[model samples]
Target: MATIFTRIVEGEIPSYKIAETDQFLSFLDVRPTVEGHTLCIIKREVDYYFDLTDDELAGLTLFSKRVAQALKQVIDCKRIAVAVLGLEVPHTHVHLIPVRSEQDFHLGRSIEVSPERMEEIAAAVRAALEG
Candidate 1:
């Protein structure tokens, strides 16, 4: 069975997309730690982050950096925190969280963001990437 991230990549599941490339996709985290929390994932169904090839890892990091840069432009934050926890979802993903301090990036913590706001944030980040 395809993982949820793969389903998003395949268009089976809807996502508020920030950016995409042939090998990567960046989108808003529906259950976000902060308003602008985003996830950058490899299109391929890789189970673990360390299991990816050196090139794959580099490509994902570079792709994520682009998204984070755009994310920072639209979201107010001191820095964009990055995390890789592959347990919840089998597919490899990088979490780019906008944070003001140490307490802002907890994995189990999430804040409710409405659908309209999610799309608005997604649109703003996408525009930042293009502009």
Candidate 2:
């Protein structure tokens, strides 16, 4: 079966896409830990992140680096935190979250942003990438 991220890429499921390339896809996390929380996934399905071939792993990180840079331009946080706990879904994915402090990493809770805010954030990220 295709992973949920693949389904999102296929448009079988909807996503608030932030950016994409031939090998990577970045989008907003529905159950986000922070307001600008994003998820970047490799096009291929790997059960674990480290399971990816070295080149694939490098490419994913490179792709996410760009996403993080864009996030920095768009979000108000001090920095973006990357977390790779692969238990949330079966797919190999990276989390890009805006963090003001280490306390923001706690997955125990999440704050939902309104639709207008989501769109505003997306546009800011997009503009950053294009700028």
Query: For model 1, what is the C-alpha lDDT against the true structure?
Result: 0.96
Task: Report the C-alpha lDDT of model 2 over 81-117, residue by residue, as the tens digit.
Answer: 9999889788899999899999998776888888778
Q: What is the TM-score of each candidate against the true structure?
A: 0.98, 0.95
Clash pairs, model 1 backbone: none
Model 1 TM-score? 0.98
Under the 3 Å rule for N, CA and C atoms, how many clashes does model 2 have? 0
Worst 10 residues of 2 by lDDT: 106-115
- Candidate 1 lDDT at 9 equals 99
| lDDT, candidate 1, 1-131, per-residue tens | 99999999999999999999999999999999999999999999999999999999999999999999999999999999999998999999999999999899898989999999999999999999999
lDDT of all predictions, in order shown?
A: 0.96, 0.89
